[model samples]
Target: MRVSANLGFLYADQPVTGRIASAARDGFDAVEFHWPYDVPPEQLRAALTAGGIQGVSINTRRGNLDAGDFGLAAVPGREDEARAGIAEAVDYAARAGLSAVHVMAGRAEGEAAGRIFVENLRFACEQAERHGITMLIEPLNLRDVPGYFLTGTDHARRIVAAVGHPTLRIMYDVYHMQIMQGDHVRTLQGLGDLVGHIQIASVPDRTEPDRGEVDIRWLLDQIAYSGLVGAEYHPTRAPGDWLRDFRSSS
Candidate 1:
């Protein structure tokens, strides 16, 4: 699989824009980041162009995390706020030439939250499709974010099915899935074409894949043969050294 450097995790020590160049220097195929609104879109676009790398994905703004908001997409009574965020994310991703956008489902819970999640995703997909970009929903494990609305592959699948939009799909994250459920191969096989984007990191401690319980190399090979993959791990050491092992794959 072609690996995209998750700039948000990979180059935490560098300026946001510099992470693009760092990824290029480390021989990454592409790059993805969590939030880019702090920097001008023009600047980010320029960095991507200069680095000669594609920007594969970005996350919608996680409204007021310090106030306990992880995302607004699934929160009831916040449909307008969610839609507005989607609009901004779509506009930025389209203008920046990104391939996908991950719509985070915040701390909302229960039946009402589920309904809101589906509707917001449908609306977001419709909006993103107008710009030829895909919208993704990922299931974050509770260990990392205890109150995250989306937390299992099956739950995410049901939501995607309910939305039934061509542009709306699952952002399958192996790390999260492995935490919530153990059957990776079968789970991935069951999902099939519903997976729009893939992210990976070592479990227990979100670190480089090298020393993890997960056989990341085999997983990478599986993804390479099947679909797209993004390296979204926190480096345990210097970024340069951590990336060296992945350079040859790129």
Candidate 2:
């Protein structure tokens, strides 16, 4: 399976361009970014081309993150802002030659939030499809982001079914699922068809996957055929050693 580096955590000390190159140097086939809006599209494109790696995914802007706004898509009466965010992300992804966009569901919850989420997602999917990109929705564990609207893979699956959009799919994050529900192998087996992308990190500590209670290497091997796995975790003190272990195990 292909491995992608998540620049959001992996290279905290480097510039975005440097991080892209670092990911390629570490043997990652592709890279993902969380809110890479700060970087110009032209700059990102050049970096990816220079690094000889694909830009696989990027996240829709999280509205006012410091003001406690994780996302705007699921929030009531913010449909306009959410759609704008989707449009911006879609345009950016297309310009950067990315394959998917992660639409954050924000902190709102309830029937109103769910309804708005579906509506926003359908709109987002339509926009993404025009650019040959997929729209991804990930479930964040409550312990990590309490009050998050989407907090379970099953719930995300139901939303995808309800929306019934081919380009709309779930981003199954092993780190979050391991904390929310322990039976990952079975869970992934059941939801394999609905998953659009996968991300991994060590459980409890959210560090490199080399050492963890969940045997992350085993998990990656099990789902290797399903899709690309993204290394979305904080770096250990010895980032190079951690990556070496991942390369050796893979």
For this target, which candidate reaches the highest TM-score against the unseen true structure? 2
What tens-digit string does per-residue lDDT give for candidate 2 at 1-250?
A: 6788899998889999999998888788899999889899889999999999999899888898787898889999889999999999999999988999999999998999999999999999889889999999999999978899998888998899889899988898888988887788888878877888989888889988866778988876675345678989988665556767778876
Task: Note the Cα lDDT for every prediction shown.
Answer: 0.86, 0.88
Look at candidate 2 and give me any clashing residue pairs: none
User: What does the lDDT come to for candidate 2?
Assistant: 0.88
Which one is best on lDDT?
2
Q: Kindly list the per-residue Cα lDDT of model 1 for residues 135-195, writing each as its tens digit.
A: 9999999998988999999899999989999998898888998899878877777888888
Model 2 error, position 86 (Å): 0.6
Clashes in each model (backbone N, CA, C under 3 Å)? 2, 0
TM-score of each: 0.95, 0.96
